[model samples]
Target: MHLPSRRPLLTGTAVTALLLSLSACGGGAAADAKTGEYKLVQNGVITAATQSEQPPFAITDSAGRPTGFAVELMNEAAERLDLKVQYKTTTLQGILAGLSAGQYDIGVAGVGATAERKKSVAFTTPFYWGFTDVLTLKDGKQDALPDFDGKRVGAVSGSVQEDFVHREMGGANLVKFKDQTALITQLLSGGVEAAVLGGASADAYVAKEPVRIAVKLASLQGSAFPMRKNGDPRLLKDIDHQIDEMIDDGTYIRLYKKYFHDPIASDLIKERPKLAEQVMNHPDLAPSRR
Candidate 1:
């Protein structure tokens, strides 16, 4: 119920030189920027925005230190691009505002890049893809959207999954909550017949108890970072190139496995291979394919 304020980690985030000097070409750092159109500033630093709380993406342990796959990926990207980077953690609602205000150069919150989001900032190719999964009581009468036509559905307010569920199951009554626990409570108390959850977050609530994946909903659309529009597209192009290279060079997979795979987090690791194939063949997602 309590929303924490920003925890500025700008001083702790490490940045490297090569990342700053690299020309924002369509591919990884310009192979030869010595004669490139732009030269990085001597004190170039990218202020990156993230959430104050969230794990596997961005989170701090008991000691209050930042650690996660995103921090590492952006740090390495900074090194490669020759730019010093600072990570600033804030609420999801604040990140975009910060991006627009120029408080941060780019925002990273495992946020999916949708046409809706594109209106605000340019998104690099998706760095990762995930999907929404619906959860209902094991003994519930529903198994899919059609089954819930007249039932009440619980979802977190402002979440993409909520939007998807509202769009996917039009007849179902939607109940909104501000947090994950609250949404689940409404579902368990029979306040709602089902709950639409984001990415691999459904498991976070049902970990200790038993639960089932009612149905695999739409692809999360995929998560991408946001940068202000305009010539930033050039920089976005370079970021896209790095992501492709990361995917091919095993860097992306390594990072994916670290955050999505492993025992501490099997939910992300246990991906539906078929879904991945479907993602590749998806025409709508082709623009930001990596």
Candidate 2:
């Protein structure tokens, strides 16, 4: 669909910030992820910025190599666009700092595209969704969380779940953790009745525990490469078109299935992040469906 043009929201200073960022961080790194060249970068090149400690979004491989669902998908997208994907990994908190300083093109971590963030950068259509669920004590099955009006809850910092808490579950006790592990650990240790985190990872952690799905709250819509404001529609169009094609051709599903494990495969995912009223959902174009 159609996203806001941003001519109205962006002030003159913000536009200057965008241009300055692009000119400084625009070029440097290129390599192939599938090939050895993917590991090495030429001296004269630009690199992208990404999250360092975040899981699912990105995490180092068992061999200590950089590899995560988002990272790999980014490499693939770069390959499809015939461009080099270079990245500097940092923390989620500092991602926006790096973006504003022109140290990187876009932040590749799991960032929720809230209206507040759009003032500084632009995001592409969402490719995946972060499944954050409600959790409770092992025996604390009350069906739904709204049932526990006065119970305490927990979530990670800079997470979509936190946003949900501040907006919807304001009456419930809410706490924030630094990461998913800590959030679940706090829940298990009785720090809170339940924790909010990505469903895939949360499911993996809560296995065999008495904790069950309280309710799958809103998802942090997964997004592809983010761009500097008004940076380059040419680049955006190319990436968007490739993603549209990937969704249609089954490549997107293959990569997602290869990295992510879930029961709600294929059809459960429909809603996506929005820039105003425009639904930035992935284009459904599987080859078989075609």
Candidate 3:
């Protein structure tokens, strides 16, 4: 499928202000869910910026509305708060920069909470967490992370996997693409030995394509929502609180299974107790109602 080029909406000083504005609060008066009032980018709508392409997480439906796990999850949460979500599509890199500029009140697109990303925006507690995986054609020569050493490996530019490639897979020939589809195409065409990406996305793709996960890399990252730093404290709190309710009521797991087409395995949950507990709603971790 054809996709628009990843380009900045604005450059120079304007770009810096949006990203840095998080350090200082900038918005209308505080929002009150009870009264149905919000300090939104536009009144009566939450301008959500997201990647135009990430599958099973963020995508434009046939009707032109954004519909996917992360997008719908946010949509449901917004419904509970009585606010409408107006999605604006952009590339992964553009979403964060635009969010920083206050162009979008929320940003979602399979974003993981990495230290580097936190500098640009604040993350909600992870709604989903899993290992990164190396994906290659089933008949490809690469079989594991070690096998790709000094060989070409594809990752979306600025994605967490790209950082992992530099930090853990040193000496690897890194090939960056604007989107996952392109990265996987390179891997299939033998342009790269393998592509490093979220295990879930890799698994989903391989289910329909002639590819397989070569290695489930040890590095684990948690995907979450990104809001401008110091942007809207009340909005942030409400979102976190809403997420807690969703987990408590099993809504999050339902969404996870619907999109990923499988439950987060029991053994995997055991390995990441904290993340599991958050999504599972252990009695001790349940949040109080407002």
Evaluate all candidate structures by whole-model CA lDDT and list the values in order: 0.57, 0.57, 0.70
lDDT of 3 by residue, 87-174 (tens): 8888778888887888888887789788889998988767765557878788866554567778988999988988879886887899
Candidate 1 lowest-lDDT run of ten: 9-18
- TM-score for all predictions? 0.66, 0.66, 0.78
lDDT of 1 by residue, 1-290 (tens): 11111222112111111112221222333232221232221236677787644445666658865666666677766666666767777755566677667577777666667788778777766665555777887765455567778888887666677787778889888888765667777888878878887646665545644555676543636667777664345556666555555544556556665666321111121221212222233323221211
Q: lDDT tens string, model 2, 1-290?
A: 11112123335454334334433442333222232122212322326677544566676667766677777777776777567767776655566666666566556656766666668777776666545667776677665657656777898776667887877677788887766667777788888887766666566555756576767643545544566674554555555565555554556666766665653212123322111111112222111110
Error of 1 at 7 (Å): 41
The full ranking of all candidates by lDDT, starting with the best, is: 3, 1, 2
Minimal lDDT window, size 10, model 3: 1-10
Which scores greater on TM-score, model 2 or model 3? Answer: 3
Kindly state the number of residue pairs that clash in model 1: 9
Q: Spell out the clash pairs found in candidate 1.
A: 17-82, 18-81, 18-82, 19-81, 19-82, 19-83, 20-81, 20-82, 20-83
- Stretches of candidate 1 off by over 4 Å are 1-43, 52-55, 137-141, 179-193, 204-210, 261-290
lDDT of 3: 0.70
Candidate 3 residue 248 C-alpha distance from true site, Å: 2.1
Better of 2 and 3 by lDDT: 3
